[model samples]
Target: MVDTKLKFGVHIRRAADKAAKMTTALSRLMANTRGPRASRRRVLMSVVHSILLYGVEVWADSLSIAYHRKRLAAVQRRCALRVACAYRTVSHEAVMVVAGAIPIHLLAKERKEVYQKKGQPGTRATKKEESREETLGRWQEEWDAAQKGQWTKRLIPRLGPWLGRSQGEVDFFLTQLLTGHGAFRAYLHKMGRARSPMCLHCGDAQDDACHTFFVCERWAGWRRAVEDELGRLQPETLVLKMIESDRNWKRVATFARAVLSEKRMELASQGPASHEGTSSSEED
Candidate 1:
């Protein structure tokens, strides 16, 4: 898969194609409605991702070209969307964060670095662990500085703690809460799918992730149920509380599922409308 100019562009495309085929083959298991998200994530990493990065150490340098990187990223993006059970409209950066999948370019660089450190290692395990730490450090820096997905960044400031969690599951309702990219009137209005950003339930504030999760009175009962168990909740401390225990995680996710399901059903009942005046400020 070499080109006339000796570039590995053809090889990269072939790898992406092969990986995409693998994703399609496992579509049933990765379907957003059915299988376990954690299992889908594992299959993505162990199979599809493995195919995409099969010889990344050699062409890792080629990832400096944005086109090559995007080609591979597109393949990963498809699987990530499934893993997070997120809407197709979510940005690549945001979806990757919610899905707990590393960026393709960074992962390629990590593989290259690990390969370079092959012979000078104390143990293969030790070197690999060190490489992962370095990669996660770089990823955290990027996450902090990123302009998109500001809402998600507020909730998950650090990738390490979120990825380290052994319990919580990612499903459609939870993904919406995590990414701020679904069902919420603010996001739908921004995407030109809704007439207004004002909350149908609250009517006093914009229906963004923050307003719906913490401020909206419509979910007060469910919210109170969670707060009764875990103290008063805020965006900053929500993730901390969620990861504190399996029961806590399930409670938070249950709140998300209950609230978002109701929101989705209500929005569906409203039907479509013409766009109205735009808001000057963005939602958090």
Candidate 2:
């Protein structure tokens, strides 16, 4: 078992090493771009690097876990070293800085135009045949589209940077925003869809995302304690404020996802019952 694990480690290391070599190539392509010629290759490389780093950061902990047992520790260590080396070449911070600093919309436009022009006969239909510029442009579109309907856009700034994440990560966050975070609660309330935006768990008057996750009664005593700790280091954006205010944000987000997951969970469980209860009390 140990020998097999060791061999697997060797294989993984070689693969990571190859990725690092490719990352260097990306760096060179980025550097090689010059004036007015529209450096599509450079832009593509940046997007690729960001995605690579995002995956590495997310799995870094799990990857380390494999090292916990003696049978796999050596392989884990080797893989870790290879990952560390690759990241050193193209750090997550660097990728974030580049992503944040650039005008993503404009870059996306450039990429689209480049791809449209490159569509010619005798060319391979595979997406790989498309220029690097087009690929990143598509990614930008996806990120923007993901942000469109839901409310996370208003909340993420306060939430702080989601370090080492790709545009794909936005989908999970978006799911939280629309369903679990209850950002949609207000919309539902406005449409007379929900019984109340107030916390059923805590009976707090203001039951937005913060109240539901941090100040609500539903979480038992633990949520409030976590909220107090977060309040001390409140984030800048409202959405992120809720996220950062809790040490259990990830856990809570998962719960929120579960709660919001069912189309009628809130409606069937809390909505009609609370609405009727309120009406009966009013009549009395």
Candidate 3:
């Protein structure tokens, strides 16, 4: 063991001597350079000096001392992060290889793409902006002004008893009206993608709200029942009359909701079957 230690010490001493000679040579080269070349030479000399320093420390079997010196220098340079030491059972190089495998930039890019796709708008329409009280007031004011102007006249019963509803319930009913329009608009928006305004269910060329509600064969029978019940009112006016009628509005609303829900369920169930039949026909 003593002989082995002596042999290792001699090799380390020789390696340290070689590193010292290399540093001396770099210093001489920097001294020999002049003018513009001197800056480049100085940078090269510094790098060579650092390499020699690391080499000498390694050869002296004092890599820990060199690492601590480097960390202290980083602190002085304002680039050091707080670090705690642990007795790592694994090799340093192995730890470094594992750390390098982490795709941090890729993860960051993915997060950015997701944010771009679904990030909320900076400014959005708020509940206060479109609140029920505000909307009802605006509509009532317009209706009153119109009645005075003879421009548009709302049915009298609609304005009288309906105005007695609390702000929340009125807002809910207004929301339901807007939801119906939105559903219609959403269908048009999708059909527009194919450059056609055809109803998806009936394939009718004119797939506006009235057509879907009143003309589409898929819902014509249901529409007749609702219209007949509402006294053969125009399709556009049926909803208003139903809502305004003396009958229990809550029960009527529930019935309307049930019909809409069942129709949606029927469509959803039939969709897959239709799609499967189309695909099978194509294969044949």
Candidate 4:
């Protein structure tokens, strides 16, 4: 009989090697270019991941195997390191989390979820010739409408040099703020997963994008480090006007990385039940 196991072993390595080359080439291309992190991140996802997952649906379960899993994980780490311009010593999970790149398995899982679903709710019907940007804009308009209920205006910063940091960081920050799919109690409650929408850290008020950064007492220690990078403590609201350039946004994104990371860790400590909402990427 043909050794299916052996063949898959070979197949995964070949896939990883190809992905590595693309990762390297893309890394080099990204290094010299300038643009918004989200834009670059989109390119990275469009290119590298598209290559890495070309036939993943058929073989994704092999990821449970230690050998194949390690090989692909290495590829992910190397690619992430290149994208973030981070050191080799950093853990891949941390690099990815900081960059806003989801775990490879999580990415695969998200893809499956998308395939199983139809479309986002409240979506405007589009022409068959609709571009991806058009769909995205419609979704954004719907999301912005829902957001108006909470804030008098959109408080999530949308200024640019989009930031000097990698697209992953910018992606992570924007996704957390605009998308309800994140590690926040408000999001969890909205999904009917959490017992309450209050801050797990303080348990006093609704935990939100702004409150997590400005109000949580559990994060005071981490907040100072973020503030030191910024010149002053950011006020409760971070309107786009405060961000002057991409350089300043990069600094803000960095601070965002630090604080949000702590909150992610805190949520992790609360156990698996806390992440029920975050486990799946569902439409709002």
What are the clashing pairs of model 3?
A: none
Better of 1 and 4 by lDDT: 1
Deviating ranges (above 4 Å) for candidate 4: 1-37, 41-153, 156-169, 178-180, 228-242, 276-284
TM-score of each: 0.89, 0.33, 0.31, 0.42
lDDT of 2 by residue, 1-284 (tens): 66755654554455445545555554443321122111233344454334333323222333332342232222222222122211112222222222232222333333344455555654544433454445445444544555332333334421125422322222222233322222334334543556565555555655554454434455435444444554432223333433343433554444444434432344456646333111110100
Clashing pairs in 4: 99-168, 161-246
lDDT of 4 by residue, 121-195 (tens): 433333222333343343335334542223312443221222222333444543354332456777677666666
Write the candidate numbers in order of decreasing lDDT: 1, 4, 2, 3
In model 1, which regions exceed 4 Å deviation? 1-7, 62-67, 273-284
Specify the poorest-scoring 10-residue window by lDDT in model 1. Answer: 274-283
* Clash count (model 1, backbone only): 0
For residues 157-263, what per-residue lDDT tens digits would candidate 1 score against the true structure?
A: 88989989987878878888888877788887887778888898669557988999999888888899899999998999999899989999889998998887778
Worst ten in a row by lDDT for model 4: 156-165
Error of 1 at 61 (Å): 2.0
* Cα lDDT computed for each candidate against the true fold: 0.79, 0.36, 0.34, 0.53
Clashes of each: 0, 8, 0, 2
